[model samples]
Target: LQVGCPGFGYAEDMPSALQNAARTSYARKLVDEATQATIEEWQKQNGKLALHKAVEDDKWKRDATKVGLLIDAERDALTRTDVGFRLPVHLAARGHASVEVVALLLEFYPDGAEEKTWHGYLPVHLAARGQASEEVVALLLECFPEGAKAMCKDGNLPIHLAAMYEASAEVVALLYEACPDAMAKLDAGQAEYVEKKRKQGAAGAQAARESVRALLDKLEARETRDRRIEPETLPQTEEETSETVAEAA
Candidate 1:
């Protein structure tokens, strides 16, 4: 009803840019919906929000229902990263999230698996380093099948990181399956990494290396057995067949 009020400008005086902004509800909605726990606030600080705090406070409780609700409420935080280091996916995979948590995160933000930390560690790398359960690692791998092959800045693959922690034999095996070439370098570099951690008095370092060694030995033996059976499964070459017949005679 107020035509050209003193503070309001005339129609000709309003620029298109200003007109668009004036028509928008930015300020009103922002003020109405303002909260301390906004996704922007959390991401700018440490990539964590109430959901992450709640998960941690609950001590890794695997309440899928509650976590699902949290995700729904804060869907925008799914891909949020720390100021410069880790992403929520990294934290989730590093033994802090249950299989359900991993699955749910991937279902919503599958690309998070490809995100790396400042140290060039993928979520799979963190999962391996944390000695997370096979199920969690499996979920990460399912989302980013090539993550196992990703090498950190230090040239450490997921298997290399897994070898540093005990009870990660299965995770190591899974990474090996994804990138068999990674194993060829395991003996030389992996042992060194484990030894360094052991000297630092890291808990279970020796035991972890032993577990990795056991898995490697099993893999080697299996490879040897398969090689011995390969000739029988393949069609014999002419020279090999003649040699075999002469040997039999």
Candidate 2:
């Protein structure tokens, strides 16, 4: 009976603009309702929703199935950010969220990998800083390789953070491979590691710098050899393509 309803009635009865307006209005109403419900749920949980808690670092219990159920319950919450502008992916990277949970979050918001915290830390940076498993780190890096080059408010790239936080060699290597220039900054990262270790204790101050340097040197050499073997693999030029076509003929 609503003559001006979206996708309803005969052509003469409803104008295109009117139909679009009605559709937009209805969609907006749905969005507003979902947003309000999410707000109330967050308030009920003391400023955090189930999605936020689902990916937090909790040691008592870890259930990927339950996490999947919660995520499926409200997929929209995947985009909701907390006070720090940290998405669920950010929490998943920094917390105990399983790799599958992280993947699910990415599936919902592929751009979430490039999203940064207020401090400019990409999910890759947090994953490295939190010492996330190599798989998780790899997943985040794969989502946005540019994240490897992003610098946080402290001016530390993901590779810098990975080395400073003593991430596994494999993790650091992933970051290094994502951005080859990261190798040139190893001295800066070594300084940070030394300063941090010195503040903790004088015992391993020199040793900490040595450790980071060792990892950096090792990965750098390996990457150099890889580059040498591959040299470069850029796309063929027009001339090269024409040559190939001629040879085929």
Candidate 3:
């Protein structure tokens, strides 16, 4: 696994030698003999390829330019999953990577949002878990709205995971907005999973969960109000009222 991987947070202190290996690979096209030699040197130096490091670097730094350069220089790494249970896009979204980096990965692999990790968390799920910016969540939703409703292997919906794991109210709000119906449709496992999170007493957990609950209340109230509005209950103009009276008469 990459040392400064997303979940581990070690990428910030990644080895200088590793960074140099990647820089050497990035300076030339993959097909060049010098590039291959450099790659061989990198392998002997670190036993991993520069492309993977570049992808990981993009995730940690949120640099779309580096990501684009790496992708252009190492297209095969586009779909390659790192040893650390993530694709390049997964790492990007999970690391709260910039929207440009996230968008670039999506453009290259539109289905990445749905690609599940070994733990059954997709990119969107990780984005929520990572407390990613609202824009990142929206970008994932734009590509795969169904991902908003995706369940982890353990049976927790994305919103449930977000409310429980993520502390950002905005991130929770974005997930809630994406799947309002899920809020009302929780089964036993879902409720239990969330209740456990609420009990954790983590900083921002209570507020984030409550914010989702408040939104659900508002949505439910709106739904009830809409359901109660029959044609007869709707406001009538004076002429319509008079017509109704005349018909009754």
Candidate 4:
């Protein structure tokens, strides 16, 4: 006759009452049947609970601050590139109140220190393209003494870009103030070419010369106006002055 305990012997050799109680306890621990309804209720509220937790932890505030700083840094760096030079130009053109940024760049990187091209355009080219306000244009011209004559690849001058875009009279006038010699050079070259064509009896040569003369007239008028308007010097703001000093260090 065999007598068995739960761990010491097989179930077939165990007392029936002890085996039944062991199985009942194992099932209760494994299944947890009492909490099934409560678990369903918690699942329904999970999304709202997660949102409240995130808010309490200030996760959104931290994320926004980080993202905003990153965007501002990226924009600042892009504004410093020569090829992406359009960025600051457009900013100044629109009078975005970021004139200080433009002033800082022009003052610090007059000839575009790290630019790759042989005739890498100075900041003046960008100002011309954007048709910046007279104040902005004058500020750039001050930094680049010969701002109007600054050339790019293939000898394209600032005036050429400005004329192509049909910028305001004020922009053209500003260029004349900075570099009258450049305008005169272009005009003289055009006139001589037109005269040669006329002497050769080229067809439509007279008409072409008339058009050239008209452009010269406009250029001369702008130069006159530019002389009449006093040039104002723009001082670098405090923030820009500090940044420039730090860069020098």
Candidate 5:
């Protein structure tokens, strides 16, 4: 009966702290219905939520654990499109998210990989243009190899942008192999990029282009061999396009 205690009255009105003395982990159902409803309302207004920002923030972009928690908070955020008609997965790829983060997003929205932005930028196209790491690039291509054949608003395939930006050889190679009938594009992409760099006075870029070309020699040889041996099989299916390259490499 602490009737004289001044703090007791305010403490009663304050929200109680979570009781976690014995619990080391929280259940996945952490967001209350009211809070989730508020979140949905906000999403309706803004067409985005905390989950979308989580992937774009550098602090949490690579932290799979934090992203997984955001996912657990609102799984539907995966499918929600922002005003730009872009999903969280699309931002994740464009932001150079880590392999773990990319995998987590894909787990929730496997079809998100196929989604394109208003400007026709697929996840793979963004990933390649941003020069995302090899593992991340490979995963996007593996998920939607058709992205290689897709041209963005700039009329450039993922490989074209990747080459123009001097992405890693591994990433460029992944895009190159994923495209069907890619030799023409590959050859043109490399020569044009090298020339563009040379004209810009980037003497170092020519050497960079050669380095990427060096790694792709085996692919070039295999493609030539296939054309001579089985010229009739000119146009392979999407699956064949990617798988055949994987096997050849």
Candidate 6:
């Protein structure tokens, strides 16, 4: 009707409500894009910012909510089924605790049922490579008891990894505490073999061999003592009687 201004239909004279709505939409889009770019930049900067920023956003508490949403939405596009195994490992290597992630996998995936990379590492291997801390190692050991002994494609165990990378001494100590055999395995015959191989020119290697030999001797003594006990605690068995009978016979 004539009550309404005829100029209202013109592009310049569009309703004030529509103009305000368009501006707000544009502003919101810009803010969203900026927020996304910030997040990506933070992630690229070694995860520290992401870890801290995670606390600020409700959707990022456990596993970034946006990532989780994207994964869910595009799960069909994922070609591989091993993301469950890969994600936790990546997180661990990146120095994120993700304890809950490890626990969830262990609880859901049966022992030895998990898929692995070409190198045969379980999530524990990733954790070992990540921080090499006592707490992280302990958690991995708890989830996969034998994970400490798991071998990489190069035949290096978790202990080997720790040694090669010079990881935390405390972590190496913790792993040795859990499985003393690992030390023996690492030093097994390596000292004598190296000594035999070096004829004359390599003094440094020879010294390393000697040091290793001394270490092995101490380890052997400790292991022997640890395995030995008072006879009172020994279990009675037919083999004990058979030995006694053989001596008397």
Clashes of each: 0, 0, 2, 0, 0, 0
Q: In candidate 6, where is summed lDDT lowest over 10 consecutive residues?
A: 1-10
TM-score-wise, the better of 3 and 5 is 5
Rank list by TM-score? 5, 2, 1, 3, 6, 4
lDDT, candidate 4, 88-191, per-residue tens: 33333333223333333332223331232334555556556655544455555544455566677757676665565554455565565455566555655543
Top candidate (TM-score): 5
**Number of the candidate with higher TM-score, 2 or 3:** 2
Which residue pairs collide in model 2, if any?
none
Superposition error at 9 for model 2 (Å): 35
| Alpha-carbon TM-score of each model against the true structure | 0.55, 0.57, 0.55, 0.37, 0.58, 0.40
Q: Where does the lowest 10-residue lDDT sum fall in candidate 5?
A: 1-10
lDDT of 1 by residue, 144-205 (tens): 67887889999988878777565354565566656767757777667555444334533333
Q: Write the per-residue lDDT of candidate 6 for residues 1-249, one digit (tens) a residue.
A: 011111112233222444334433443454466655655665666242343333223444344333332222232222223334343333433344343333222221223212355676655565555543354455455435566666767776766555555545555554555555666666645423322322231443234334434433443353344334467655558998799889999
Against the reference, the lDDT scores of all candidates come to 0.58, 0.62, 0.60, 0.41, 0.64, 0.43
Error of 2 at 2 (Å): 38
Q: What C-alpha lDDT does candidate 3 achieve relative to the native structure?
A: 0.60
Most accurate candidate by lDDT: 5
Candidate 2 residues lying further than 4 Å off, grouped into runs, are 1-48, 59-62, 188-249
What range of 10 consecutive residues in model 1 has the weakest lDDT sum?
Answer: 1-10
Report how far off residue 109 is in candidate 2 (Å): 1.2
Writing each residue's lDDT as its tens digit, candidate 5 over 36-100 gives 46545544654447778778878779977667766755668888888788899889988988866
Give the root-mean-square deviation of each candidate in angstroms. Answer: 25.9, 19.2, 21.1, 33.8, 22.8, 29.3
Candidate 2 lowest-lDDT run of ten = 1-10
